[model samples]
Target: MTAVAAGSYPTAPGYNVNVRSGPGTQYRVVRTLPRGARVTINCQKPGQAVTGPYGTTNIWDNIGVGEYVSDAYVRTGSDGYVTGRCG
Candidate 1:
């Protein structure tokens, strides 16, 4: 598994990504990040399995303290170890 860095800015490629309260769609929607939005990945972990224009992945990126958006809609340039793991 790769870590999405704490300050790395990953972009949303296709449409808007739903920023959720947690790492899955089961969580409430905190906001919607427009396409091309630079998301600051605070940490990353495997959560819900999500598929988007990019593909399917279990990697969920923490954008803020509790704000999470799936890696499915986020292009982090690499598939692994872009940042540290969440506690």
Candidate 2:
């Protein structure tokens, strides 16, 4: 596990991290990710974003996709759409 670069795409080579719409605890479950899930992150925004009728919580944005993970979930790599180590 390493530090995921902010505003950068995830690259764990088989990581399936969660993706929410908002940035916090109140967010609901928007969707689950599988292995090699790559998502772009918006460092400017923090926490989880909730959306839809259920107000699912997960990494999200109008611009692109973001990931919700700790420093231990993934390792940093060159900026761009990197494959995730999903389980």
Candidate 3:
């Protein structure tokens, strides 16, 4: 699993933005992040979590999904979260 600290941009296209209670697949569906949403990776863990109200969250990272996005999916630097399309 990749170790991405909080404040890192997602490197995958059309990545499933599954909202969790904490930060894993185990948590309930807080919401799903739309494609190109600027996500600030927070933490990383091994395997999914299975014990809380959801299940097992793991093999992923956490982040604070931005509220609104502009036409700038590409992340050049860590200034803030951005989403759109990259050339």
Summed backbone clashes in each candidate are 6, 24, 15
Winner by lDDT: 1
lDDT of 3: 0.39
Off by over 4 Å in 2: 1-8, 11-15, 48-87
Give residue 22's lDDT in candidate 1 (0 to 100): 88
Cα error of candidate 2 at position 36, Å: 1.7
lDDT for each residue of candidate 3 in 1-86, tens digit (9 for 90 to 100): 99644454543355544555553344566666666556654433343433322222223344434222111222424323222222
lDDT string for model 2 (1-87, tens) is 998664544434555555444455455546656776554444423334434322233422322343344322333332222344222
| TM-score of every candidate relative to the true structure | 0.83, 0.38, 0.42
Clash number for candidate 3:
15
Among these predictions, the greatest TM-score belongs to 1
The residue-level lDDT of candidate 3 at 38 comes to: 62
Runs of candidate 3 with Cα error greater than 4 angstroms are 1-6, 49-58, 64-87
Model 1 spans with C-alpha error above 4 angstroms: 1-7
Span of ten consecutive residues with least summed lDDT in model 3: 65-74
